[model samples]
Target: MTRYTPALATALAVLLPVSATADSFTATIAAGHPPVFRWIRMISDTFIPTVTAELEKSGHTITFDEQYGGALAKVGEELEAVEAGLAELGTCQSLFDPAKLAVQNVTYYTPFVSADLRKVGEVIDSLHADLPAMTEAYGENGVVYIGAPITIDDYLLMTNFPVESLADLDGRKIAAPGAAINWLSGTGAVGVAGNLTTYYNEIKTGVYDGVLVFASAALPGKLYEVAPYVTRAGLGAQYAGSLCANADWYEGLPDDVKAALKTGADAARDWYTTELETAVGVSLEKMAEAGATVTNAPDAMRAAWAKGMENAAAKWAAELDAQGKPATEVLTTYMEAMRAAGATPLRDWDKE
Candidate 1:
């Protein structure tokens, strides 16, 4: 009887393999920010379906465990959540993950860098292709880097007061965080740490005179209602965000799955950029229609603001060096690469 039991168990174990022949895989994706517009919807509506369709053609069924609107994580926590495997993949905002993603901050420091989305996209692809250290950084956090270059529209200042000239900005409270604070320093505009999610309330209560933001986000946030003066400084553009995957999970995927994931990310990047191109123009028009004072920053104002950012680049490098990392080298490499890519950068930040 015992021998029969053993034989039966062995037979059942062998049958397990045959029984589980279904070719289905699950992908868990999370985004912390609310379901606002282009960014969040691109992943949900466009990228996921595109990847799923492609995967199906390869004889695999896919399921998405989507946790959008912060169901899985809070703002600034998406990457960390993905790192912890709370979700399989996610949108990681480098602007928020400063410590772990400082090298990614290269664009943030070098303002007026480039507004051409195609150029920005090419640079990002090149950066991933060239910078193993960036991959290493992502790896350190238990995630694999996937390039979905986020194209931020030109940065602008929207205020309650009409800032016609450099002198008009004097003594105003400007909401510009990180290296952006340097853009407002000595203009008598005090710098405050702020993001799009909170700028409205900040401006409503007079916490800030205006914000250093782009119309793409600012209009949707209804910031124009609070601060009607919109100044287009056109501080070039930037690679604002990225998509990443859990390293262990991503590395463990079959080659086809890996390819599909990349395809999905590329699609997302393309769709998001295209959508943003339309949105930026539309948002500006919307703001104007809503009675906002839209105008360009005076040449002297732009020059004065650019000059104010002189010390910040050096300050960032020194801060990074004091932490015992080769911050200066990273900064230089990025600048050189940008110039090689035909970007005539305004600030030589590495030496600043």
Candidate 2:
């Protein structure tokens, strides 16, 4: 064999692209919820694979270590986990972490706006992409907002007692998650702060008379077993959160790698919205077949419920505005987008 020389090695290096060596990367993705949830499922079934495939095209490979079901970070703590590098990425749930993601919780405060999950997802995802204010909180929290917005389906009231009208809700205790608790205002019902983790058990044990929950989660959590009276109150779909990456780690990645990550998130968003739409119908049907009474609230009652509620959006935005969080901007942008998309709200939340 010929003797090795520095000149020969240098020439070989110049002839080959650095990527020809195939750099490998390891990413740990975290989610508070388990794989059974569609958002988490999207991370595993779509995001990781899409990113891997894209990276492979550039002679790079990535392996994902998925930590879900609060294995790595509990609900409301995912952003902190990713920020601190406990995981490289996570589903930063705004609904649960309202203090940190105040602007992202705009949809939750602006109930009765739209029940279309696709519209809500599209508007919120677009806001994240085009609006700096929408993502400034993420930057401040040491995370970078990516795509894959988690859009919950239209919320409804499920209770053990029959709710025929607003009168039925008088003095009743209803549980709602995060800012959604404000939704019970002027309805004569007592709003209790709660989450999906405890909704079913709480209702069964007389802790809550009902829960304002979504169809996608309600069916899986088996809320129907305890709260058989399903009243479609039209609380509207909401933007709960999105995927985020550790700012420090993400900034250090190569441009190509960064691009791959975003592409994966887009794929996840599409997959999640599609799956959620189908699941909404399936969940409702399955729950009804299991002996739950599913009834749509009359138009008059729906309008009255919306009109009578306190203007939580204005109040919430004002509170965050005092904190310098651009909450009002987010609310206006979202409401305007929804109206442009053909949604006629019972009340103009931003205008009021």
Candidate 3:
């Protein structure tokens, strides 16, 4: 046992008192989707635990009240929920909130770039850090951008009928989500705007012939049941959503709490991406085992589809420029970054 002088003991008591009272905060995190979705699940499985662990190191703690599966907000309402303080944090789907987060939907317009979900996620997350415009967009909507960007695996077309070429899609009704509807332009396919939740019922009732979706979701949603034909169109992976915090709430957080949240986002991104990559392969195999006809769209057909589509990316960027946003600059920067990372895009949206 070590003995201390009265003066030394008094100094120790003073210093110990500082951390004795740990600041505790209550945060409500909401998501439109259920915990079945990988990203939403990670918020609990990875993010909350990681942040809790990190905060403990600094003698701070946060208790998260999870509200997922539309218990707090409906699909496409997460951003608003967070902005209005209905939820302190949320998974904001930029794909759904195109009018509010147009820039964050860049990957949707720039298709055929790369199929690497990890690369797409990291690149977009990096943009949020390097480009003030990226974060500023979220700020304008009353949210602080967190680092983890929820990216999906490569997109494929699932149809009731087989599609071996673009011609097959001619006069066929194809359901696409939000900005992805533009991808059907000049391909002779009639593009109807749709979302994942309605894909099953719509296709089952012939509301539409099929949908443009990804493997991870398609498998779980049992989209293969309605649309048995899976054409790997290589439309490219995409960054659809992100974790964000209410700006006002985030600003009032203790410094250590903020740091822990940031650190948690970073770790969650890594874990989520790895799990996603593994799930993609497994999901595809499972779909095939369930008797879904899975085929890789012929290279020539893919090239034709890319060449035939109208330059929606250019048009989208121009619209943003007209709105006084750095759309063109972002397009260029994104393409350059993709190329630098060894991505060989079939169509350089900015250049052509």
Candidate 4:
């Protein structure tokens, strides 16, 4: 025998425990959108590969049972669907879950904080590090936020009407999805219910005159196929969605698997962001070449709207505070960071 000693045996025993501790877990992710959509690919392909690869590297195995394109949940019910433990995880747009995911909308209230999706995304991710209070809001409904926060590309105005100034926007039927309608509040533009999917059709049918949509999603969605006037209103992108997990499912996961999933989530966030950032430029070019009339919203209008947001921000913050969520902190942190980053608010619709 080479060496049969207690000290050597003890060393081997310790290494054995270390090696034995690595294990894998199976995670199921849910999405209500098609796999071809960029959002879906991030979750099903990019996130899956990144996380599973990380787990395997760390001696953990991760298998995903993915449900996309509403195979598991309806389009708008992702928050509830995830919370009810239907699927282990899903991508949810906070704006869509107004009652449940109210806390995540803090940055949306403080507009122009970041036109750069990546920067806004970083702040949100950093804030989400230990947002148990925020999570508790989700947890109360049986959902948990894991991995990364979801940030959207900047909201641009693709309109049937020409808007160079606030005056041009007066009395026009403005189709704004979610809280973005608040952005058009006082301009005499009627806030109609329209999301990216419906905007182009609504425009074609004369349901609304214009749309507030992001280039990343809209270009792929081809909203310009209906609306010809695409104005670069330059409303900063919002941190609009999140990667949410089923609390019960998450708790059931092994520690190593949980860590692997988180690693995967980070990879997915970066991948989604990279695609979003690239899409913005590319979408605009395609829209421009396709005969969409494009122009920048005037500085005066942007300044005017920025001034009006005070009351809206305060009201939105207070709403969150009443719910016992850290809305004020989230809002304040975002506004301060954006200001520090040289962000000037575009419009002040909350002002009288």
Predicted model with the maximum TM-score: 3
- Local accuracy of candidate 1 as per-residue lDDT tens digits, 1-352: 4566888987977777432543778878888776675778888877788788877766677898888888998767888999998888888877778888777776777776676666776676677768774555687788887767767787888999998777787788889756677777667777788877789998999888898988888887999999999999867677756888999888888787788888888888888888888888999999999999899887777777777655666677778778765567667777777788898766666655
Off by over 4 Å in 3: 1-10, 13-18
lDDT of 4 by residue, 301-335 (tens): 77776554445777887777887777776666656
Rank the models by lDDT, top first: 2, 3, 1, 4
Q: Rank the candidates by TM-score, best first.
A: 3, 2, 4, 1
- Estimate every model's Cα lDDT from 0 to 1: 0.78, 0.91, 0.90, 0.75
What is the C-alpha local distance difference test score of candidate 2?
0.91
Instruction: State the lDDT of candidate 2 residue by residue for 1-352, as single tens digits.
Output: 9788999998988889767787889989888898888888999899999999999888898888999999999988999999999999999999889889888988888888888999889989998988888989999999998899999999999999998899899999999887788888888999998988898889999998999999988998999999999998778999989999999999999899999999999999999999999999999999999999999998888888888888989988998999888988888988898999889877899998
How good is model 1 by TM-score? 0.87
Q: Write the number of the candidate with greater lDDT, choosing between 1 and 4.
A: 1
Give all TM-scores, in the order shown: 0.87, 0.93, 0.94, 0.88
lDDT: worst 10-residue window of model 3: 12-21
Query: Could you tell me which residue pairs clash in candidate 4?
Result: 24-61, 302-346, 305-347, 305-348, 306-347, 306-348, 308-348, 308-350, 308-351, 309-348
Q: Per-prediction count of colliding residue pairs?
A: 0, 0, 0, 10
Alpha-carbon lDDT of model 3 = 0.90
